[model samples]
Target: MADLRPQAMIFVTEYIRNGNNATQAAIAAGYSERTASSQGSRLLKSVEVQQFLNKTEQNLNKDLRVMFADHAVNAFNVLLEVMNDPEAQHKDKLVAARDLLDRAGYKPTDKVVADVNTEGTIQIVFSDKMKKADSS
Candidate 1:
């Protein structure tokens, strides 16, 4: 990515922090309110800006995955505690057990319902090649 001006960098940071509100990000980054919307749109169209945003997003996702993994063990332990505690409310225990089972990939099967409104006859035909192969 090309070097970005300080204001542009601020705009990018604010853009993400503000949930992709370009106009708000621009104003927060010191662009005039009158031109912030247009400036934000133009910046978003820049190749360098787009690259920076994508890289930032990828990094954020990586960080989030790491964070989730770090907490997963503790979360599972909490669920187990709740499930095993005799003093825990039955409903709460059931909920925790369900959550643990879900996280462990033992979720209940989903049933699909289909309504058929057409009737059709079924027929089977054998080709000459099939008949010859069968005889052989």
Candidate 2:
């Protein structure tokens, strides 16, 4: 099966729930006007829809619009490579995210890189100022 991200699925879910046009979702998930509607239809009917809708919707923030614009533009910037090879998409997304963060002046490295167990769940540790009571 294809690797569909929850963020993409939420775009589909909101489109369906709102009974809106594919233009919105198309714009959201990095697709073109010529193919947005068809792509939305495909995502709407995807089996992964149920597993992701609620969580993705909850996680989407105001910055999503800006981030999405970056994703689409970045994706199209590498369209030639994407058409000739599938592996390039991941690189495209990573570059897109890095570019988005850079443009917004958000540096990921400054933040703590929480370690995750073999299961891939991140384990976050808090700093002293982030807590309440004084130390004994």
Candidate 3:
């Protein structure tokens, strides 16, 4: 389970279960459409957000009777087929590859952690995006 607020849990689950559409998920989470894409991208980078997504995906797979090792293997096999098919759309192949990588425990990004003491003060640091921006 993610240590996120209730609204965030809703956003995370909706984002994953709804074709990975962040904008729609943000809207469903009550964010303004004008800022939804950026908000969704930010949420996607949160450790708690990714954790919730992975947890929910696992739960959903289990509920769908696809949690068995054999089933997972079969699913991967299908993804491979999609990825290798010459006639497959580029987008379909990319999606299949992404799904395969995700199911096989490949994370394309590192996590950023923030530690706050029991005091009432807060210390925040930007790591991922800021680092890239600075390098650029």
Regions more than 4 Å wrong, model 2: 1-3, 6-10, 13-19, 54-136
For model 1, the superposed segments whose C-alpha errors exceed 4 Å read 110-136
- Candidate with better lDDT, 2 vs 3: 3
- C-alpha lDDT values of all predictions: 0.89, 0.63, 0.83
Q: Tens digits of per-residue lDDT for model 1 on 3-74?
A: 878888888999999999999999999999999999999999988888888898999999999999999999
Q: For residues 7-31, write the lDDT of model 3, one tens digit per residue.
A: 7788987887689999999989988
Model 3, which residues run further than 4 Å from truth? 66-136
Ranking by lDDT: 1, 3, 2
Candidate 2 matches the true fold with a TM-score of 0.30
Count steric clashes of candidate 1.
0
RMSD of each: 11.8, 19.5, 22.0
TM-score of each: 0.76, 0.30, 0.46
After TM-score superposition, what is the CA distance of residue 71 in candidate 2 from its true location, in Å? Answer: 37
Superposed Cα deviation of residue 52, candidate 2 (Å): 1.5
Please give the range of 10 consecutive residues that has the lowest summed lDDT in model 3: 107-116
